[model samples]
Target: MSTRPLRVVVVGGGIGGLCLAQGLHAAGIDVAVFERDTAPDARLQGYRLNIEPVGSRALHDCLPAHLWHILVATAGDPGPGMGVFTERIRLLMREDAPPAGRDPSEQTHAVSRVTLRRLLLAGLDDVVHFGEEFTGYRQNADGTVTALFADGTSATGDLLVGADGANSRVRRQLLPHARRSPVPGVGIGGKLRLGDGAAWLPEELVSTKNMFLPKHDFLFTAVFRRRETNAATVERVGDQLRAAGLDPDLLVQDAKDDDYVMWAYVAHRRALPADLPADLPDVPAGGRGRRLRELVAARLTDWHPGLRELIARTPADTIERFDFATAERVKPWPTTNVTVLGDAIHSMPPVGGLGGNAALYDADALRRALIAVGRGEHDLLPAVAAYERAMLNNGFAAVRAATMYLRLATLPSRTVRTVARTFFRLCGVLPPLRRAIFSD
Candidate 1:
């Protein structure tokens, strides 16, 4: 181990980047985070995330106990389990069904991405630099690394980590050949306030659930049932945030909402025939909350009435369309002072809902490796190499698995859909088989 303290420059202030920073900071390692977003609310923080055991464990290991408490406090209402259904509300696999590898102690929950990010940002007052977009990096002859930002400023550190999302600049510079291609689908998603209307949705559907319609489209819904947010709860969260030195007001806005439901409609890119009305409006780039509801509603004409009504009644401003991308395969690179994690190294479709979870796993694994190096337990280069090896093996496998699952789910063949549905149903019955099929 080097005599000097290990200095790590993380090129992204996302979940993975922040998690690594927290762990390294806790371990007494010097780390800095650079984020392009000017402020915590620079953009609309996305919807809910299904945090699996791997991700939850990472948080448990990386986050300070208080922050972890906040995370659990803000978590959505607990569901019995995830359910799969058809467009007509035909139950294919119920959440009440026994899971394959049931671990009652290892419970997974849905959390708002925005809330999770805020919790991760806690106690990093001086470590994170906002508006510092990473442009690239250069390995110094002295075995150090210099990360350049768009503002012409740069930070030099013993090691560099590209936890930036899929379009990571560091990954681009290191492996220019690695590029993300479009998957054969598109998605329309939005959030709705589920106040009294919560009674209108099916109890199972309003809970954590996925609806796989036979029409090559899918709907995923997660309801954030109202939680007790009286003065005491607010004071507790406020006190925790202040104790962690985070801005208490950062969470005030979110606490105002009692309940919400996030929903998405995903389908093959070519679901709409070319012969359809050419005058259909295109979703605006920056608009949100229902801009594309009509276009999506038009495509879902043949879907179940309930599903179609959900789209049609959606507040026009909440809906947005996302063009899906094909799975990415990262090419190997020589290990050096620079490295990457999360989507920077392996970005895939959301088919398996493991993208965020995998990112957390990457953060935890990389943090462990780097902490070992900081403690002189391992060499820096070898530590990074080992981290990359494990990351690629797991990350690439996730990408491939998500790709395969997406292909099968969205393929316009009745035979393939039947087989896929049957396989999922079977996995529920066979715990060993479920363990094999479900990666995250």
Candidate 2:
């Protein structure tokens, strides 16, 4: 291996890029991050993340101890008891499910995305050039790649990684002939503030998060307790409600200034009727709040009144929408010089919570690959190829699995939906069996 420290340029500073940068930096490699955003705090990072053991362990194995501590402090524990539910019965899928194996405490965490981002961002000592949007790139015959940003800035590195996210400009520039991933579905989410001692449902339901998989649709809801930092951020959420068509002033008055709130994500397959004409390429907007409410009402009408109550309380301005679509696979990963990670490489359905875990794994695995290359056991290009092989293999499997789960959740037939729910419920009850299917 060359004694020279390789200079790496990572596009996109989200989970994968940031984590990889952190891991690479820890290895004493020269790395820099380019973020398209004008600033890190320009927009509030949305919602929570539940990184299961596999994903969590990957992070632990890669990130520094202090960063991990910060993540844990900001994290919320969702006992294994928090699970997939269709009405009252917990739906189970997987062959390893065993009787009495479903324990809420054994599960992972519910960490706010902002907290995770902060943890990763804090560990970076290298300058992450912001407002540097990636426009294109060209590779030299010497195997070096030059990346061009829209702001007329440029960087040449041993390798270029397209961690830029779903609409990756680097990915486009690399394979101009490849079909850009079409928007497959729309995702809408919002946080709802309710009465402190609100009468909603059983304590078990309110104490932990819940998933509502109705015959017509699916909804993921998390009850966010009021926190000091989030409280200030939520103040403006009221204005968003008004913009969405709900009375912003009325919404603020309905809940105490200090009451905890519920955050909900409502998704519709793009193949379905365009619920909102105006959300965005892959996220939600306040203007589509009313449309989202209608979708929720129509789908979960038969499940629980509590859901309806929450939806009813949502302000029109608070709703946001986005489309969810990703690349089928990425090729030509760098082994000696560069590699790709996170949503930059494989974008999957969030149903199985694989996105974060897979990203962490990429960081861990790529680091190992780089280390192997350093040991002279494998050439850089070959090592990069190996990483691509493994990641894509895993990516295909995850994308296919998540897409199936999504279809099952939004299945049209009551019988099919019931069967799907029952299958997952059975898996939940049977630990070994559920382990076979759901355990990564």
Candidate 3:
């Protein structure tokens, strides 16, 4: 067995990095997660995450029993599965019902990214270091990796895992040739509060998650009931804040009722005319909620009235644009003492909704590999090599599939859209056809 303690340095304190730290801690390994954000509430946590079985399992396997309970308690109700529809609200395919032989355990769960991260941060008081932006890493002559942070500080560790998301700095140092090309699409998303007397949206449409696939564009909407933030939960989080030396009043705002409808509008990059005013009003960064609504309305003029109304009624400050990009196929590198997971390795478009789940799976696999190496059951390089091979093979395949779906949804030619609409309509009515079309 290796005499030195396995000190793992994880860059990026997102889901993948946090989960890996949790798992390593559970396995009695020393791990430290360095995140760029200054604090827990430094930035917007973004929208909800649809965690499938793979991601849920990663959490379950990594988190302690109590933390897992908190996660499930705080998550939104897993209503029915996703519903596919047309711009006119016509149902094309309902995937709520699982396939005949699918396992119940494979169902998806909806979770708020903020709440999930907070829950994962529980009991990890000393492990996660926030506000430390990762700059790069250097290999030491004594078989160790030293991670450099923007703060002019550094930490040496047995291994470094880059989970810094799509635009990872660690990945740049590791594979400078790796490419991250922008997928030719613009994604605008917003949230609408659907509380008392706010029944503008049809119940059926908001009752379950729906995806409206119109010609040359795509839209997805899901209504999630926010988990009640009870006094106990707030108190717990407050304690965590104090432990981290942050002000407890950071969360002093009264919690709002948990009823909101979130929706996203996606279109081809060329959908909007090139001559659109470049100097069109500018909203402060992170303050583009209203501008996002206006942008959506302007770009989706030909959409259905109901769909357009949703965007119109949405509060301006609640809307924002999502930065979308796809990762290039990364060539394998020597697994020496550095590696990467999640978006740092393979990032795909959101059309397939596979990126998060794949990241979870990667964390789990990498955790197991590191554990093996720690136990002296396998050499470090070989174990990491095996994990990378499997991850790249599956990850890139998912990327290709998502790219195909994105193209299909954003077809430039009208004839292609017509044929796709016809085929989807047929699939909506025919069970066999639906199964075949959606079959894994």
Candidate with the greatest TM-score versus the true structure: 1
Instruction: Please provide, for model 3 over 1-440, each residue's C-alpha lDDT reduced to its tens digit, 9 standing for 90 to 100.
Output: 56666789999888888889988998988899999998875643577787877788888888776666556655665466677777878877776365455443355667777667776676788998888989889999988999999889998898899999999998899999999898877777777876675667776456778878777688888877645554555566555455544443433222432457888887777875443222226645435566567777886688778788888988766676664689999887877889999999899888657898888888888889888888878777788899899889878987998888777766687788777777777877887988776654
Worst 10 residues of 3 by lDDT: 248-257
lDDT of 1 at 385: 95
Question: Each candidate: what lDDT?
Answer: 0.75, 0.62, 0.76
Compute the lDDT for candidate 3. Answer: 0.76
| Model 2, global lDDT | 0.62
Give per-model TM-scores.
Answer: 0.89, 0.79, 0.87
User: Given candidate 2, what's the lDDT at residue 193?
Assistant: 51
Candidate 2 lDDT, tens digit per residue, 220-244?
A: 6655442334434336453443333
Which ranges in model 2 have alpha carbons more than 4 Å from their true place?
88-107, 123-125, 177-186, 223-277, 280-287, 329-338, 374-377, 428-431
Determine which window of 10 residues in candidate 1 has minimal summed lDDT: 272-281
Q: Per-candidate RMSD vs. true structure?
A: 3.4, 7.8, 3.9
Q: Select the stronger candidate by lDDT from 1 and 3.
A: 3
Q: Is candidate 2 or candidate 3 better by lDDT?
A: 3
Q: How far is candidate 3 from the true structure (C-alpha RMSD, Å)?
A: 3.9
Of the candidates shown, which would achieve the greatest lDDT relative to the real structure? 3
Q: Per-residue error at 219 for model 3, in Å?
A: 1.2
Model 3, residue 218: what's the lDDT? 81
Candidates by lDDT, descending order:
3, 1, 2
